[model samples]
Target: MFRSIVKQKIPFLDLKIQHQQIKNEIFQAFEKVYENTSFSGGAFVEEFEKDFAEFCRTDYAIGVNNGTSALHLAMIALGIGEGDEVIIPANTFIATAWGVSYTGAKPVFVDCTADTWQIDPSKVEEKITPATKAIIGVHLYGQPFDVEGVSSICKRHKLFLLEDAAQAQGAKYENIPVGGFGEMGCFSFYPGKNLGACGEAGGITTNNKDYYNELQRLRNHGCKERYYHDILGYNMRMGGLEAASLGVKIKYLQGWNQRRKEIAKKYHNGINNPAIKMQSQPDWADSVYHLFVIVTKNRENLMEYLNKQNIFPGLHYPVPCHLQKAYTHLGYKKGDCLNAEYLSNHCLSLPMYSELTDENVEYIIEVLNAYDDE
Candidate 1:
């Protein structure tokens, strides 16, 4: 039992430690922005977008103000609207469903696979209706959803496929990256993401030329010309400063993802306890392990024990999107998405940043095993 001598102690996510490592380079990035005072979308943002597109193996990339904005713009470009419906997994951040709502489309909630915590592609076809215009497949918790299966369904049904790659930036399915798998991929650059910005930022990736251009227009003030207006577009431009910060982080995403994979592998192999089970990986997914969540029978007690030891953990979602107050209009009751609702209660994310030390991991496991013995 460790007690803090100085009172204040260890952190769940130490951005100070992370920022210290890249201080010089990050400072220079900020200096360039200050020198130019180019805050809005410009050369800096464009360069980052191009670099990110190549990273995702997509033909084009559009930088936006935030991940939610990216999702909304992607939906708009697909011409999704009031009469149309978008199918989304119930086990995701509210932003996923909200994006569909932003386009004046109804989001149809679908269940997730018990094993992978991702949208169950096998169940997708059953939900398809004449009003189904698109499918927003989410790669939840850094593991890529079954893209091949969902893609086949969409192709057979002639529906658009959008990849919500917010948490799966470096994750892959069978050697292909997640972003390039669907028609368009939306990413978030919130401060805690795998490749985060200093503040809010996001990007979209696509291979289709027409969709890409229309998305570009949608991200701007919906104008193809500098001064002309067109569709009802949201001002979702990614700032130059955020782009610059993200650029520095993007260069290290591969390395950081590799580290996260190593930690996840350790967690999978360690913590020998039957009362708790780590999130399982799909056979085809080359997951980046964005969050090493575990399902536990004694979730509340385990969380309390970890907290007592200063081992801060996170609950990815205590409430599923469909059950949230904002989405009560979806008309889904408690038992509707049982798997998702159950997972929300049992699923808990361990401290999983790239900077987490092996000693700390071992300590966490040791504490977990000790608690399990009780």
Candidate 2:
């Protein structure tokens, strides 16, 4: 059965209602694109890049097809290639690992912080080597990773720092946005993201002139002029349509993120069950609560019970990248990634979005508490 008809049920990341609210504005953006017939990189994309770069407090923001492509382009722009190594957290989505692999660089898996589920800064130096060229820090669940600690480690070892800010559109680390701290930051605008566009879209932000210029060329067949390929490149440009939609959505991002934070605060204070552990934030960081996840002992049972009540939840990285069959060449055996394994088994995402009704959130918590009461 379809979910919209179901009454009083919390659905995980409802884009339908969100889209409904902004439909007219979104259509106007599309209409502008249709009027100009400028479907590729044009005024819309450039204006969005400028606006987003300003929002992220970076010198440049280069739009692309998806977060994966953005990451790939960053690695390419940085000239990280075969025989190189890129260290990344084992707990992130597979795209983080694949992005490194896309450039023929090896992915060195690092352990996660038990509390934050981000790359443990203390464990970073141990993974560095002569081949370790870059470190990709993922801001998991819209929480900023420890950029201060991570950047210090990277500087000491002379490694590039890349921010996977896919889930962290409005997140901040010590009053600075998550993307601003890294050498380059990549953001995804997939429908489920906090600052989602109408479809798959992403961008890279950077302060380096070389990287910013290189990213522009990299996304457009390595050409400043049409039909020209200066270097080997791929087609990963963000369409004008997507950019138009994103530009419209970008206007409301901060307010929506604030709303998400409000919802997370409510969830934090209201879920009084011992069986569930809410995701905690560090004092120095401000998370946008993209997922509103929890750690539960009986996660599978809780998921099924919620689903029975027409409430749908989400799972971010049910399997860690290090343990995947494709990455078996990395020789990661079971228990090698201790914290990631623990998180993979225990983490479960609750219904979280800008439009989540208060009654639905309370009722969802009630159901979980009732389950625990048993």
Candidate 3:
């Protein structure tokens, strides 16, 4: 007699569970926004900006519409424009490059390190030319990149250094927060981010008063005062509702990040598959594990097997930005970024969230260890 196997359904990320945990506080924040009618950038946005600045240990924070807008404003404030070249990791999201492109600058691609899957600082100098204006180091999947090496390169080359801390809200390197390491760090408050808002939101952290003031104007049609436009800009201001939601979520960020770390530890200890290659975390990095990625040559089969077991996973990016159809004009070929191309083919993101239970993690690990190429 044949018997049916029972499968436990696991989601890649369960935002509903997280919402239920903080539903009361979130609703109360919404009520306050309603009472004040602070729909545009107002007191709510200002309060969250203050809180986020203190949280990131920076002198100033300016909230914007989204991470892309934040990056765009940063590029403008730093005086990057047409004919300028900005170096960025080839494996990162296209938004990083989009920010540079929006400012009429070309994005120069650099290969990522194999072990850390971060921008290879050793390859940076070779890409620099007279047009090189900045170097963007992305803290991919919550792990802080080699800030020291990248910062040294920036200093020696007299280029601006920017940190794309979109995936690493509470992560740290050498005990300093990731957002405070560069001249300006950009953060995303997308619904799935560590410190997410109800809707889209983003911000920038900087110690330079002039940069801060310029960013403030840039996000609001370049208006320092009502009816006074100082420079041409976009309507990239953050809404009060999103700001209020973020305010409520920020208070729980540290604890949530700690929980995520605990979950990552369990995944590290439980999944002992020879085919799986986990990301390496450096001693100086305290990653929040936004997405627990595993690399395997048999990614397609593994994803299929997990689906059969009712477990869903994800791919951080199946296509590297350099090889995307949108960037064909840049004249990049398949072999331009070897490590990033390798990663794009093999990387798989497992279920990772603060709300995931031990039972869920163990079951997922068991299934992963049980996968067979046959």
TM-score of 2: 0.96
Encode model 3's per-residue lDDT on 309-336: one tens digit a residue: 8889989899999998888999999999
User: How does each model score on TM-score?
Assistant: 0.96, 0.96, 0.98
Error of 3 at 264 (Å): 0.5
Scored by CA lDDT, what does every candidate get? 0.86, 0.88, 0.92
Query: Better model by TM-score, 1 or 3?
Result: 3
Query: Please, what are the lDDT tens digits per residue for candidate 2 over residues 1-374?
Result: 32233375667877899899999999999999999986988899999999999999898999999999999999998899999999999999888888899899999999898888889999989899999999999998999998988999989999999999999997999888878777899999987899988888999999899898889889988897788888887899999999999999999999999988888888888788898887667898899988887888878888888899778999887889999999999899878789888989988899999888777777777777667524
Candidate 3 colliding pairs: none
Give Cα distance to truth, residue 144, candidate 1, Å. Answer: 0.4
lDDT for model 3, on a 0 to 1 scale?
0.92
- Top candidate, metric lDDT: 3
Which regions of candidate 2 are displaced past 4 Å? 1-6
- In candidate 2, the residue pairs with backbone N, CA or C atoms under 3 Å apart (3 or more residues apart, or in different chains) clash, namely none
